[model samples]
Target chain A: MRFNDKLRLAWKKNNSLVCVGLDPDLSRLPAGMAQQRESIFEFNKTIIDATHDVVCAYKPQIAYFSAYSAEEQLEQTIQYIKTHYPDIPVILDSKRGDIGSTAQKYAVEAFERYQADAVTINPYMGFDSAEPFLNYQDRGVILLCRTSNRGAGDIQDLIVDGVPLYERVADLVANQWNKHNNCLLVVGATWPEQMAKIRNIVGDMPFLVPGAGAQGGDVEQLVKAGKTADGTGLIVNSSRGVLYASNGPDFVEAARNEVIKLRDLINQFR
Target chain B: MRFNDKLRLAWKKNNSLVCVGLDPDLSRLPAGMAQQRESIFEFNKTIIDATHDVVCAYKPQIAYFSAYSAEEQLEQTIQYIKTHYPDIPVILDSKRGDIGSTAQKYAVEAFERYQADAVTINPYMGFDSAEPFLNYQDRGVILLCRTSNRGAGDIQDLIVDGVPLYERVADLVANQWNKHNNCLLVVGATWPEQMAKIRNIVGDMPFLVPGAGAQGGDVEQLVKAGKTADGTGLIVNSSRGVLYASNGPDFVEAARNEVIKLRDLINQFR
Candidate 1:
């Protein structure tokens, strides 16, 4: 299935827009969690099994697995996700943006090797850097617009031609990319006000909106900022706010509940 | 030996400012001269053998090698350089710039995996993204400032708080990075005026100046633009113009002559 259609189906079947960020920080894993080589795969599988019906996608931050000597484990983690959580979209949050050749290698890693449904990419290198991802018709390439961080404003909010860099990026990710393949723009819920403007600019490209929970972004305000005639194109991601809700044995169940609550609130707005 | 000291010694031995670019285009190699799989390494090895002592450094553009599926061959090619030409600085021309964790992975790839003496990095990510690279004091992180490309002025020349983006990067690479590790800057030879201005901002941080030969950059103007007090901070590079000097069986000899010619002209100015 096309990534967008699969995402739509996943969103409806799960009754949620919550994406579990599998950022397995070795030091930050729960107190009693063992440090085995396959600990990440084990942790991720449990979370997927418990919360499969309460989440739209799984977002894996590449850093956590890349830090160790067992770097091959990252490939195994993705293989497990593709096998067990096959229906749910996996967004490999790599944030890569380089020249044409290196960009091509990353495209292979995400699509051919890891088989991620979508991947987060940095847009600093301009159109040439992103062209490789746009070649995959069945996948989604989420370009960073206004990221959920303090320093995002340092560059994302810069004014150029009376438009913010994020808005300009939204236009490019919409117009230029659609000519080739699927594209999504990342808009943080913290900057809800920018969401409405971005929605209007990009028309209806799917938005992977992050920062809806512990980051303290107002959910109601964020929903108001992103409402379209079709109310679809929004994936409000909550990682730490849900996955790390409780560090005990009930962590996955606690995560499911948090997702359920957020989904209910979002359903009301829809 | 430390990277800086090795670079200085190599420069003294070479009496050459030239940094031969190993941008091995697979199709351009001599017929049956090893197929595309290991052609890049095969070609690079021949060039290095003929002219290793004539150049201070060897710059391998990340895109060229990445364009092929021979990741293993690329790794082997680099290992070959590090093994045979240990003193010849191999600056991996990968303009990678991303967030903290991913940046750390790239540092691991460039420093540990490929074992480059210096890796060109992108500075659009700001200091935090670059901090991971700076933490590796044993290596050199060359930040891209004012590039030699036509579209470079699109972003790098942007003024903020009374200083250009390139100037801001230079200031940050000099001040913030020196706090942790050794840092260098990339100032393209095509932009002599920007090179002179960036030299002032970055002081004596070695500038990997590309764009002299096939790229139509003026070497004499570049030599004038980047000459340091000790005549040490410029490693002006020529890629296709030097490496592709001839396509026949005598290609290596022709390639060596090209390097010798460029090196003589640069030394004359010095």
Candidate 2:
């Protein structure tokens, strides 16, 4: 099935648009879990089991695994998610960008190796870098538009012709690059005004909205500006805020509660 | 030592600016080697042994190894370079970009896990994405300015304040982000004219120039346009052209011959 169809199914089944970002930082893992070899995967499994019914997607940030030389764990984590919670799309949050040939290898890494349902890509290198991923017609190719970072405007807000560069990116991705109807934009929740503009440009296209929790993006503003007419377009992510909600033995329950609260909060505005 | 100091030492010792890109595709590996589990590392070893004396740096494109679940082989490849040819710097061609928090993990992946001397990053998300990598003061942080791909102009050539986006990148990277003097720009050999303008903007700052071999970049134009007044500002790379120069038993010798010819050709322009 195409990523969009799977996402719609997830949205309807869960009654939520929240994506729990499984960015398991070793230093911050729950009390006794940090010392184990399979901590990252174990932590991810616990999180998935706790919150799978409440979220539309799960985004695993590749760096968190690869940094600690735990790529096998990442593979296992995604495989476990696919095996158990297959309805929830796994978005490998690796913002990879390169030339065509190298990008092909990255596509293989994200899709074939990790078995991620969808993968995020950096669009700075343009169409060819994205082509290899787009060729996987069933998967999602989410492009970074207006990033959540404070310094995002350094490059993204530069005026091109008359519009901000991020707007230009939205126009191009929505019109020229969505041939497969699998392209999604990463419009940050921190910039609600820009998010609304991007929504205007890319009608009904889904967005992987990051920055709701630790990055201080307002859930009300994000939902008000980004939701589709049917109220099912945003995959709002909460990483540190959810995963490390409580570092004690109650971490799992805390995470589950946090995700439920976030999901309900998003639904309130929707 | 700092990345610049190490690079200068290697450039002086090797008498060549060629940075052979170790992008070992499994399907493209030589006869009798692809079936072996250690083929990627062995092939890299042969290439490094053959060309270490003539080249200033080695770039290992991370995707090729990670695509095949051979990241251990990538770690071994870089460790081998550092252990054997200690003078040559290894640039991890990752092109990773993310918000600050995730970027920290990527820095750990490149510097601590892979032990790369330098790493390439996509600067689309702006300064925060590059900061974690820059914090490692002794290592190199190479940012993509004008990529070598055909679709580079899609976002790079857009007018930003009367100048191209790439030029703006050059200005920002050179003036603001090079605080530790560890930042470099990736200007493709395919666009020699744009490269010349970048050189003018970031004077004497080194460039990691790809697109030299299979990408059909002209050596003469690339060198004439990218080289500094002292003729030492470029690390020209060749991947497929060098790695798959021959798929037979004589592949090693063919690769060495190709590197020598490329180095000499670059010298002619210098």
Candidate 3:
């Protein structure tokens, strides 16, 4: 099935858009720094087990995994998540973009190795770099139109040919990539107004929103700004807000509570 | 020492500005498919062995390794080169850029994990993303200026506020990142005119020029246009033109012949 159809089906079947980010920053791991590689798998297993019912997808930021000893370890971490939690779609937040040939490799890594349902990409390299990723039908290629970070506006909001850089990127991803519509835009929740503007430009494509908890972005305002024409297509991500709910021993339970709370809030708005 | 100081020393020591690219394309591996992973390592070993003394540096485009299972293998390849051929500076051709936190992780991965002597970065996300890579003294961060590609003019040639995007990026990476002065610009050999313009703007910073050889970039024009004030600072790369010099068993020998030819051409121009 196409990514959009799968996303819609999964969203309806799973009843949530909460994507638990598996960014297990080594410094912030709940326990076992000595077992750096295994901790990610262990922590992710509990998080996935606890929150699987309430979320439509899981986003494992590749940076955190790739920071370890070897690519095999990174693969192991992602593989563990996919092996056990087969139903939940994995969005590998790799943010990879390069020339055509390299892009093909990244595509293989994301789709073949980790078998991610989608991978976050930076579109700054132009459409050529992104074409390889967008070519995948069963998977998705999420472009950072406007990121959730504070400095995202510095460049992404710059006026280029009158339209902001992010707006221009949004137009390109939606229009040029519309031949496949395998592209999704990332509009951070921190910028509600820009999100609404991007929502207009991007039309019906799904948006992966990251900034609800740790970044202190307003969820109510975000829901207001991010509703698509079909009243769907928003993956609200919370990293530290949920995962690190309790640094103590009851971390998993604390995480469950946090995810349930966020899910309820999103559901109420939806 | 600065990147150019190292490049100049190596160039003088090796009597060549040639940087052999270790682009281990799976389909074109010297050995058959069964040993694809091992063949990539073996191919790189031979290239490094044959041209280590002749070439100033080795550029392993991260994408080629990423094309395979792509996690541990890419890291392993980088480690192998650095450990086995420690004298040869490995310039990881990864044009990475993102917000602050993500940038930090990428820096750690490139500088710490891969132990890359230098890395190619994208300036589209602005200096903040590029700064982390520039923060280290031992490593150099090469920013993409006027790229050497068919679509080089897409966003790169865009005149923003008065300056072309590549020129603007060159100025930013040159001036802003000099807070540490560990910055280099990736100016293409194809855009020798623009490369000179960017060099004039970026002053003494080193330039890693790509798009020579099989890309049909004019070596003479590139040398004439991009000569530094001291008549150096160019690391012209030739991937397919060198690595895939032959489809037959003399592939390694053919690659060496190609590099020797390009090296003599560059030396003659110099």
Per-model i-RMS in Å? 3.9, 0.7, 2.0
Candidate 3, B128-182: lDDT as tens digits = 7777787887688888777776766756776667777777777766766677767
- Tell me the lDDT of model 1 at B23: 73
Task: Give the lowest summed-lDDT range of ten residues in model 3 chain A.
Answer: A69-78
Tens-digit per-residue lDDT, A1-270, candidate 1: 788888989887887777877766555565588876567777776677777778889888765654443345667777777777788888888776654545786787678767889988876656766778888889998988877655566566666566776787788678775675488888888898899899989887888887787677888888878866766678888777776778887887887888889888987886
- Where model 2 places Cα greater than 4 Å from the true spot, the runs are none
lDDT of 2 by residue, B1-270 (tens): 999999999988988999999999888888988554478899999999999999999999998888878888998999999999999999999999998889999999999988999999999999998999999999999999998999999999999999999999999999999999999999999999999999999999999999999999999999999999988899999989999999999999999999999999998888
Task: DockQ for candidate 3, please give it.
Answer: 0.53
Top TM-score hit? 2
- Give the count of colliding residue pairs in each prediction: 0, 0, 3
Tens-digit lDDT string for candidate 1 (B34-71): 65666777788888899988999988875566445455
Better of 1 and 2 by lDDT: 2
Docking quality (DockQ) of candidate 2: 0.90
| True-vs-predicted CA distance for residue A212, candidate 2, Å | 0.2
Give per-residue CA lDDT, model 3, range A212-240, as digits (tens): 88888888889888977566779998877
Arrange candidates by TM-score, descending.
2, 3, 1
**How large is the interface RMSD of candidate 3?**
2.0
Error of 3 at B196 (Å): 2.6
